[model samples]
Target chain A: MKITIQVMVPPYSYEDLDTAIKIAEAALDKGHEVTIFLFSDSVLAVNKLVKPVKADRNIPEKLSQLIKEKGLRVEICGICMDYRGVNTDMIIEGSNPSGLPELAELIYTSDRFINLMA
Target chain B: MEKKVLFVAYQSPVGSVWPNEVFRTAFGMYGEDIEPAVLFLDEACVTVSKNTKPELLGLFPLTTCHRLIKRYGTPVYVVKEDLERYNVKEMEEIFNPQILSRVELSDFLHQFDLVIFM
Candidate 1:
């Protein structure tokens, strides 16, 4: 099945990012094609400046790597990123900036759509 | 064209006005053309509680989203795990809402053309 996920919660804390990552990994491991669209505060998940201060996981880096290795489509909401003052240079490598039009298109085309909000 | 839109509200309806605003927007935009299905999970389940009295908050005290949307023939389901976790089983006794499990929720995702999480 093709699964499209909209992550609308910011990954300010470890628990939040962990949950999002786990869900994405689980969906992929279950033999489903996955696309993650980051919106609202969730755009922070791909912010390059927000480093994992103490945790060993480094979720943003992990997400970036996963995007490259798994060929996962990672789209951050363009409007949301602008509202949050997130620069394109600050976005983690491999993730693309997108808007609601793409989000609507993904939802229309996917077999399943999941929203992980914080 | 008629489409299936699954709306997921994951926030509390009291402290924040987002739940109502988003729903109102969606209803206005797609109410006539789409079959809207709502799922209340996590803190969002409180919005459907029979005991909730939104009147005291001085806002438009519209607590029963199920009833409001159902009037328009939309189907609303509340997550059973969330209700159990919040000790809101009494809500079911009062409102008789459809109880949905995780698997059932996953299946519901497959049936929708679009899923919006607020």
Candidate 2:
């Protein structure tokens, strides 16, 4: 199945990002196609400036690696990123800024969609 | 192409207009071509509980969107973890919404064509 996941929850507190990563990885492991869109507070998950402290694995780093290794496509919400004062410089590698129109188009074209929220 | 769209509501359902706005936009955009399902997670689960009274808000109402979506036969799933945190697990006893677990959520992800988070 072709899966497109939207993440809209807080990046750190909840396991939404972890879940997205796991799902994406599992989907690929199972030979399924996957795509992810980060929106709302979840866009913060892709902020490269936010690094994990001692004893915590950096999610953004892990996601970026996964994107490269798996050839995953990620679209972060432009409006949410702007409202949150997140710039392209802070975005994790391989992720791009995107808008609602792109999101709408993604929703229209995908074969399967999942929203992983807080 | 006809696809299934999953709407993930991660924000509080009553305190803000985000959830309602998302629903309106998704409904307007997808129309009858896509099957839309609303899943409430974290604080967002409050929108579906029977005890929630948005009438006090006096603006758009709290459960108005929930009611509107249900009228279209949209299935709303509440994350069990969130419901437990809010001490609103009893909502299932009243409203009978599908309580989703991590595994169930992962399974649901596979069933949809697209998942949009709001």
Candidate 3:
């Protein structure tokens, strides 16, 4: 299945976004093609400069590994990132700057669409 | 088959729009072909409590929620820990929701085809 998962919540505030990443990983392990889009506060999940608490999962690093090792595609919303003052340099490497048009395209093309926001 | 939707209402009624949105949407989808289930987790357990009356704030009435469940047969569930921790009493008239443990709740969430958290 070509699955599109949208994460719309920040990492430290709750566990839903992290669970979204883990779900994408599981879907990949099941031989499903997974694409993740970060929107709203979830744009922070890919900010390399932001350090998470030791108790919390390292979201940026996990996102990088998902892109580099698992070949998972990721897009961070450009407007949302800019709204939070997240510059291009602060984003996790390999995550493309995406707009709402790409999100709309993904919605139309995806076999399964899941939005994990809390 | 109808799409199985699990609405996770984990927000409190204290100035949060989550309870209202979840209830309104769930009620709206009642007559639709979708199979909708509501799970009250964390602070949202208060929403299904018999004592809760958001109508005082010009919000939806608790009786309307009862009517939705009675008329549409919407299944309602609550996290046992949250219900216990909050000490929610007089639970009989509040939809008579099924209570599940934390681990059980996680397992139950997987049963739905779509899960939306509020």
Candidate 4:
């Protein structure tokens, strides 16, 4: 089954992103295809410049590693990026820049859609 | 079959983008393979009241959303208590909106494959 999980809050702004990752991990382990849709401030999750101390969790790197290791498809909303002045060059390497049309396709094709937001 | 998505709006549109954002997503994703619906709860019921134009206040163009909802026959639900709480006389621009009691809404909500809260 295809599952599209939308994250709409900034990374570490809340536990939404963390919970979404765990859900993705569980879903992937069950042999489900996962797609992460980044909307609103959650687009910041893909920023390569978010540096955290060694003691704290490096949230953006974890997202990148998830893309590299678990074959997760991550799509950051283009309109939302423009609102926050996020450019393609500023995002992590693996994720793709997308728009609402992509969101439509994912919602239609996916068997389940989970939104992580306030 | 396409997945069912329910947008549960609990916030008022006053000085907030969340309410209109749902309609934006709905307009973008409708007419595809997804079945999208909106449920007005809490203060959001005010937006559905007759003669109130959210777009006139420079929010998302709700007129366009109304057109899409009419064109595509998307389902709209509202809690009975919310209408009374918000003092909304009626939900306009929507055809045959389902006005369910809280009890009925609780059961009706689970039918959808996905729930997005705003």
User: What digit string (tens of lDDT, one per residue) describes model 4 on residues A37-73?
Assistant: 9998889888999888889887778888988988888
Chain B only, TM-score of each candidate: 0.79, 0.78, 0.86, 0.84
The estimated TM-scores of all candidates read: 0.58, 0.60, 0.52, 0.86
**CAPRI docking class of candidate 1:** incorrect
lDDT of 3 at A75: 88
Model 1 error, position B85 (Å): 22
For every model shown, the clashing-pair count is 0, 8, 0, 0
DockQ for model 1? Answer: 0.16
Candidate 1 lDDT, A11-96, residue by residue in tens: 76536556667777888778778888887777888887775558565667878887887767788888779979998999888999
Native contacts present in each candidate (fraction): 0.20, 0.28, 0.16, 0.88
Residue range A25-100, candidate 3, lDDT tens digits: 9999999999998877788888888776789678889989999988899988887788799989888889999876
For model 3 the TM-score comes to: 0.52
lDDT of 4 at A101: 90
For all candidates in order, the CA lDDT equals: 0.71, 0.75, 0.78, 0.82
Q: After superposition, how far is residue A4 of candidate 4 from its true place, in Å?
A: 2.2
Best by DockQ: 4
The residue-by-residue lDDT of candidate 4 on B29-105, one tens digit each, is 76577788888788877767766676677666556667767777767788898888778886685645778898897
Candidate no. 4 TM-score: 0.86
Complex DockQ per candidate: 0.16, 0.20, 0.10, 0.66
lDDT of 2 by residue, A17-48 (tens): 88999989988778777788887788898888
Worst 10 residues of 2 chain B by lDDT: B88-97
lDDT of 2 at B89: 42
